[model samples]
Target: EAGVVQSPRYKIIEKKQPVAFWCNPISGHNTLYWYRQNLGQGPELLIRYENEEAVDDSQLPKDRFSAERLKGVDSTLKIQPAELGDSAVYLCASSFGRGRSNNEQFFGPGTRLTVL
Candidate 1:
């Protein structure tokens, strides 16, 4: 019955350091997603997980960014050797998988990352 949950609502790190964020989707939700929001831009989908499989991740930066959803539940996103450009709000969202009439996504308060 709980909404999505995310941790460390704010994070600050020097450039080139590594940063990680976590999220727990709503119970019974079959889909989860990770998104990045740069200042003045709308959130862009980084990855989408249907159950435990990553159904889409073309926008994710494989060079320094990675993510995983374990056992089809909680998920984590990591950015290694962070860059100043990587500073943004990392949002997590969930919803019932596609094919349903009411598959509206529910979003969590994003983890704000600052690269100094």
Candidate 2:
């Protein structure tokens, strides 16, 4: 099966500008996730999806960030009025199951969004 895929791989925008990123999870995977990676840091969960349901999203920055998994398949994450501090890699990951023993997720290369 194909692995997760992301677009642009990189982006640059000014503060207060709008930016959007796209993601496609692995085939047959029922769980998808979006994570934020700050420089020199591990990925932090932003949101998670179990098919069409958002099973976890407590860490999303509601003030300027938003995300959705349309049709429970492909997902998109957007940041309206981006801030300079938002500059980081936005990673998309997917997993075969949500069970504790099957929790390892496959990750995309990520979209490096830089708000200048």
Off by over 4 Å in 1: 99-102
lDDT of candidate 1 over 57-111, digit per residue (tens): 8999999999998799999999998999999999999998664325799999999
Q: Residue 33 of candidate 2: its Cα lDDT?
A: 92
What tens-digit string does per-residue lDDT give for candidate 2 at 1-116? 67999997999999999999999999988899999999999999999999988888899998989898879899999999899999999999999887442688999999999988
Error of 2 at 11 (Å): 0.4
Q: Which ten residues in a row have the lowest lDDT in candidate 2?
A: 95-104
Residue 51, model 2: lDDT of: 90
**What's every prediction's RMSD, in angstroms?**
1.7, 1.3
**Each candidate's clash count:** 0, 0
